[model samples]
Target: MKTLVVYYSLEGNTKEAAEKIASSIGSDIMELVPVKDIPKKGLMKFIHGGSGATMGKGTELQPYTKDASSYDAIVIGTPVWAGKPCTALNQFLSDLSSTEKVIGAFAFAGGSADKCLSFLREKYPSIKYTVSLADRNSKKLAPENGSKLSAFIEELKSELISN
Candidate 1:
């Protein structure tokens, strides 16, 4: 079955995990980038945060040519910022509505994993399956993250195939 790994990576933490997930499942990858770059640090970051501040309402930002409809399953990932998925991911996800898409998610956070998972679960109630992967820092991937994420993806794949 076709799968898409869509994610928003800040400081590459999320990207590292996303890459592993893609390779494990052979899923196409899509990196979610803001049309406007974010400040790596400083007061500007505190003020605008990320995508929430710059993205236009319903902004598509970096568009992709793939037919999302072709994917039998979709996995999403994001870095947690201040106990939530980065603002950009939140804005971007707001565009999706109920369809028959099979969905899964993994989140990377500096420390607290609960907060990001709570937010995403509430936001995307339609998601069929979900997972959360976090590390203590935003700069690096969690140890053994690739193995853990791949295991979950494999489970999802098995279920899809059985059905």
Candidate 2:
């Protein structure tokens, strides 16, 4: 089955996890980029990003070349921002046509991914698998987490095959 992994990352944590998930599942990957860039550091980033996520705002993104409809499944990865997915990913999900496709989600955070995962579940009822990682920063995942990612990929494969 063909699967795709799409994500938006600001601190590189989400990007690290997305890449690993894609590699494990042998899926195509897409990174969402916003037309307007968010500041990477300082209080402004925290204020803007947190407010945007808390308010469920959507940002304009650079045109994505890949059509999500072409994939049988899509795994979305994100880092928790003010307890929800970032603005870029929020826009992507809002604009996505996920009809007849299996959805999966993974979230990373310094403390918790509960809010992010919950938000995704509500938004996409098709999500069949989910993973949450805590305290992951802008670095590659550890070997143990890599094993867990491999297991997640296996579960996705199993679910798709059964369906």
TM-score of each: 0.76, 0.88
Instruction: Give the whole-model CA lDDT for all candidates, comma-separated.
Output: 0.67, 0.81
Model 1 misplaced regions, further than 4 Å: 50-60, 97-102, 136-141, 144-147
lDDT of 2 by residue, 7-65 (tens): 99888878988888788667899999999868998989889889999999999999996
Residue pairs of candidate 2 with colliding backbone atoms: none
Q: What does each candidate score in C-alpha RMSD? A: 3.6, 2.6
Model 1, TM vs. native: 0.76
Best candidate, TM-score = 2
Residue runs of model 2 more than 4 Å from their true location after superposition: 99-102, 137-144
True lDDT of residue 63, candidate 1: 67
Best by lDDT: 2
